[model samples]
Target: MSLIDLSKHVALGIDIGGTNTKFGVVNHRGEVLEKGNLRTDEYEKVEDFIDALYEKVHPLIEKFGKEKNFDGIGVGAPNGNYYKGTIEQAPNLPWKGVVPFGEMMTAKFGMPCTVTNDANAAAFGEMLFGAARGMKDFIMITLGTGVGSGIVASGKLIYGHDGFAGELGHTIVKPGGRKHWSTGSEGSLEAYASATGIAITAKKMRAEFAESMLNQYPEEEINSKTVHECALKGDPIAIEVFRYTGQKLGEALANFVMFSSPEAILLFGGVIKAGDFILKPAKLHMERNLLPIFRNKVKLVFSELDEADAAILGASALVWEK
Candidate 1:
C-alpha cells in the first residue's frame, strides 16, 4: 500500500461482527462503490470464515479494479489488534485464541491489510469521512449492544502499549455495583450504558414500578429500541431509564475528558438514534460532572455517518491512516 498512489487506488473495508461480516469497496472520498454481507456465525473455523469472506469480496475487487486500482484491505473486528493484526480472545466469536487475521487477509487479497477493533475503526472513519473530519482530538464512544470507545489525540488514534488502548466500556464507573455477566465485574460502563445495559435497567425499573408501561409487554420485549419508542410516546418508565443510563455515560465521559481534554465526544450506533432522549441528559450530566476549569468546554454530539455505511467505510479508512 505504501507504493500505491492512494489518490488513484480504492480500498476494501471489512467489518466482522458477532452476527455478520460486512464488506465494501470504497473510494478515497468514502463513497462505498460496492458492499455486501456474510453470516459470521455459520462458520465454525476461522480458516473457513476467511475463505468464505474472500469468495464474496474478491468479485467486487475484480469488478471495481476495471475502474480503479485496488490499494489494500482494512478490517475491523472484536478484540482486533492494530499492532499485531490479530483478533484476541473475542468472547462472542466462535473462533478462539489470537488469530493472525491481517496476515490471512493480506495473503488472500494479495495486498496490505490493517486490523483494529470495531470502535477504533469507527473513530477513524469519523475522522476521515464524518463529523470529526477536521478535528484531531476527540473521543468516539459507541453505544450499541455493548459500549466501546476510541481515543484520538494530536491527530492519531491511541492504540496504547498493548494495542488495546480504549476499553472505556470496561472501566468501572461504580465500584461493587451491578455485575457484568461476561467480565463478571462490578459497575462497568458497559453494564450501565450499553443497549444491553439499558435492557437491564428497564428490567430493574419494571421490578420497582408495578405500573410501568414496559410491564404491558413481555419482559423480553422491553429492549433498547422499544424503550426509545416508549420514551418518545411519553412513557415515564422509559424516560427514567434513559435518564439513569445517561447519567452513568455522562459521568464517564467527563472522567475521560479530564484525562484527554478532547475537543468533542462523538456518540455512535443505534441507541444514539434516540436523540434528545439520550443526548440532553448526557450533555447536562457531562458538563455538571466536569471540573470548573473544564466545564462546558467539550462538545458532546452524535455521529454524522450513515449507520449502514459507517463500519465498512471506517474499516476501509484504515488503509489511508498514517
Candidate 2:
C-alpha cells in the first residue's frame, strides 16, 4: 500500500477585497480546509489589519501544521504587484501610498509570501482548479465593486513588464462616457459594468419610469442585489439596466478577444448572479462587434468556482505556483 505524504501540501490563502478580507487554509488540490473573513474597511492602518488577520488565521495554520508542512502564504489584492510584492495606491483599499504587503505578511506570519493583483490570482485559480484547466490561453474578468481582469497566454498569467498587465476594466471603452467612482476615469468599462455601476445605472434609469419597481427602494438602499431582485420579478427598468451594462461589457470584450484571441473569457463575482440577464447581452454584443473570424470562436462563460471560495482558492494557488 502506498502512503500519501501530507507535508508540503498545505498553504494559507488570503484575499483582500475592498470591503472584506477572506482567508483560508488549503491543500494542494485546491480544496479549502477552513476559511473565515474580516472587514477590510474596519482598519485605518495596514499594521492593525495584518495583526487582526494574524489573530484569526494563526489558529488555522497551527491546526494544519500539526501534521503537514505548511507551504507559506499567498495574497490577492487590488493593484498588488507580483514582481515587487507590493500594493501601490490601490484606490479601493483604505491604506494610502505603496504598501509592502508581502514583506508585512512574511514578517507577521513567519512565512514566505507571494502577492499579485486579485484578478490575476483568480485567473491562476481558474487554471489550477476551475474552467480554464488544461487551456493554454484565457481571460478571467471579475465584476465586483469594480471590474478587474487577468489574462493568461500560453498557460501563463501575463504580468507584463510591471506586473500590472491585463487591467481590462480600466481600458477605455467609451470616451467621455460614465465616470468611475474611484479612479475618476471617464468611459471605462468599470463605470458601466461593475456591480456598483449596475446599481448606479438602475438608480438613474428608474427615474425615467415612474411605475418601475426600482423606485420602491430609497436611493441609498438601491444596490445590485436589489436590482437583481427587481429584475427577477420582470421589472423592465431593472432588466434594462442589466442590458445596458451588458452591452458595454460586450463591446469591451470584443476588443479583448481581438487583442489576445483567447480560447475563452470567464466572468466571475457577485454580478454573475444575474445569470442570463447579463450573459445573453454580453455574449450577443461581443459577437456582434467581433470580426467574422473572431466571432463564434471565443467562449464567454461564468466561473465554476463558488464565488465565496474562488478568491481563497486563487490566493492559495499562488503558493503552489512554481
Candidate 3:
C-alpha cells in the first residue's frame, strides 16, 4: 500500500540520532498517530540504515494508509543539511563523507522528503508544537552528546550561506583552548558543554575528590545522568561539574545574544536533565556577561517538548511548513 497523499492530511516525522532513530505520523493538529524507535547501530552502511528505516516505517505507513493521510516525510538528523539534502560527515554516525539522505528517503518512500540538522528541527518543533510556539525569534539548544543549536531570526530558520548556520556548539567559546572529542574542532563549545564534555569535566573533578560517592560507580558506566543523580544526592564534585558546565554555556550564549537579540534561549536534551544544576549557573554567567540593554530582556527556558517525540515533530513540521 502507498503512503498518504500530499493533498490529504498529516505528515511523517523522522528523527535520526546517533543512538536511535525515531519516526511518527503526525497531523496538522499536532497529534501523533504512531511512533517508535530503532537502534542506529543495526545498520552497517548508510544505505543499510536507509533500508532498515524504510523497512520499519513502511509497515506503519501501510497500517495507517487507509485511516489517516500523510502529506510527506520530514527527517531530522545529525549533520543533516537542508539545502544539500545530505548528512555530511556526521560525527556520531559511522557513515563517511556525504550521504544523499533526502534523495534516498524520497526514493524509498515515494513521497516528498525534507531534511535538516537535528538542532534546526528541534527549534522548528518548539515553534510548531513546543515552547517557542507563537514566538517569532528564539534559539533552541540541544544539550546532548554534543551541543547543537537552531537559530530563528525574523521567524525563519537561519540556514546561513552554506545551509550550516546556527551551529552554536561550534562557536568558539575558548579560543585555542581545546580540541573537540569528535570533530577536533578547536575551542568549540562542544568541547566543554556537551554531555560528553560534562563527563570529561566530571572525570577530572572525580580525580580530585577521591572519597566522593561518585567513586562508587564504575568509570565505564558513568554518564551525565549518573552525574545528575550524584549531584542531587549532595555530591559536591558533581555539583561543581554542572556549575562549571553551565557557566561556560552561559558565557557562550551571552555572545550569541549579542548577535541575535533573541527573546528566549530554549534548552533541551540529556545534559539539560541536570536541571537547576546547569540552568542556575548558566543564568548566573549569562546575566553577568550580557550588556545592560540585553540584560533581563532575554529569558532562558527549558523545552517543554518530550525529547523522544521532538525530532519527529520537528521533522514533520519541516514538511508541514513547505
Candidate 4:
C-alpha cells in the first residue's frame, strides 16, 4: 500500500460569472497552476452546464494526477448559498429558481465542494491572501457593474441565518432618491455607487454642461470608462460624476463603519481604476460623516490582489478555508 502525498496538494477553483465561467487549478500558496474559461450564457439548462463543465474540467484534474492529490472544489457564483449548497434566484443567471450547484458539482466531479456568493468568496480571498491578511475584522466592497459587499466580523463572515447576509449594497442611503435599474429599489446604495451608477450620473450631468468633454460621445457610448477618460483630461463634468458617486459611497461607508466597526474597508473592481478621482472624495465624506470617536479609525484602501486572477484565487481560498 502506498501513502498519499500531502505536499502536492491542490484544489479546483471556479468563478461563475454572468458571461463566463472561469476555472483554475490552485495550490495551497494561492498560485494558479493553470486556468481557462467558457461561455456561461451558452447553456440554458443547469444539467447541461454541469455536464459541459465536467467534460472540460475532468482532463485538467487528471493532469494533476486525478482527485487523490486534490483537496476539493471551491466555487463562487451569483447568489450562491454556502449553507444550502444552492444558487437561488440569481437574476443575471439563466437558471431560474434554486439550483443545487454545489451538489451537482460534487456529483459530477467526484469531490467535495464548498460554495458561496461571489462577494463572500472575494472577501475570503482577501482574508487569506490579500490586503486583509492578518486582519481579523474588515469589509470587502466590490464596485463593479453593480455594487457588492462582504462583511467579516470577529474573524468570520456574517452569513446570518439565511446565508444571504452582507448585502450592504442594497441598503438605502437616500430616501426617495435614484432608482435601481433592475431591482427598482429607490435610494439604495447600489443606485449611486456602482459603475452603472457612475455612467448614469455622467449621462445626466453632462447635458447641463454643453462644453463638457462627455458631449463628444453619443449617449450610448457614454459609460464609466469614457467618463474616466474625460476626467483624466480635466473635464469638470466627468470629475463631478465621480465626486457625486464617491459622496454616496462614502455616506454608505459611514453607515457601515458604525454598524460593524471594521478595521478597514477594502475596495475592489473596475470602478476603483479611477484611482484618486474617486478615492479622495470617498475618504473625505466618510470621515465627515463619522462620529468623532469612529473618525480616523477605519482605513479605506484598495485590495492587494490582482484583479484578473482575484476571482479564481478567491474561489480557491474557499477550499483552504474548509
Candidate 3 segments exceeding 4 Å error? 1-8
The candidate that wins on lDDT is 2
Clashes of 1: 0
Give the TM-scores of the predictions, in the order they appear: 0.95, 0.94, 0.93, 0.95
Which digits, one per residue and each the tens of the lDDT, describe model 2 over residues 168-250? Answer: 99999999998888789899999989988898899899989989999999999888899999999999889999999999999
How many clashes in each candidate?
0, 0, 0, 0
Off by over 4 Å in 1: 1-7
Judged by lDDT relative to the true structure, which candidate is superior, 2 or 4? 2
Please, what are the lDDT tens digits per residue for candidate 3 over residues 50-155? Answer: 8888888898888777766767899888889999889999878878799998998888889989999988988888888889998888998989888899999989
User: What local distance difference test score does each model get?
Assistant: 0.88, 0.90, 0.87, 0.88
lDDT of 4 by residue, 1-322 (tens): 9975655889888888888898889887788898988889999999999999888888889999664488789888889998998999988899999999999889888899988988888888888788999888999999988888888899898889999998888999998999989999999998988988888899899988999999999989888899999999999999999999999999999999999999999999889999988999999999999999899999999999864366677778788777
Model 2 error, position 150 (Å):
1.3
Which stretch of 10 consecutive residues in model 1 shows the poorest summed lDDT? Answer: 1-10
Residue 239 local lDDT, model 1: 96
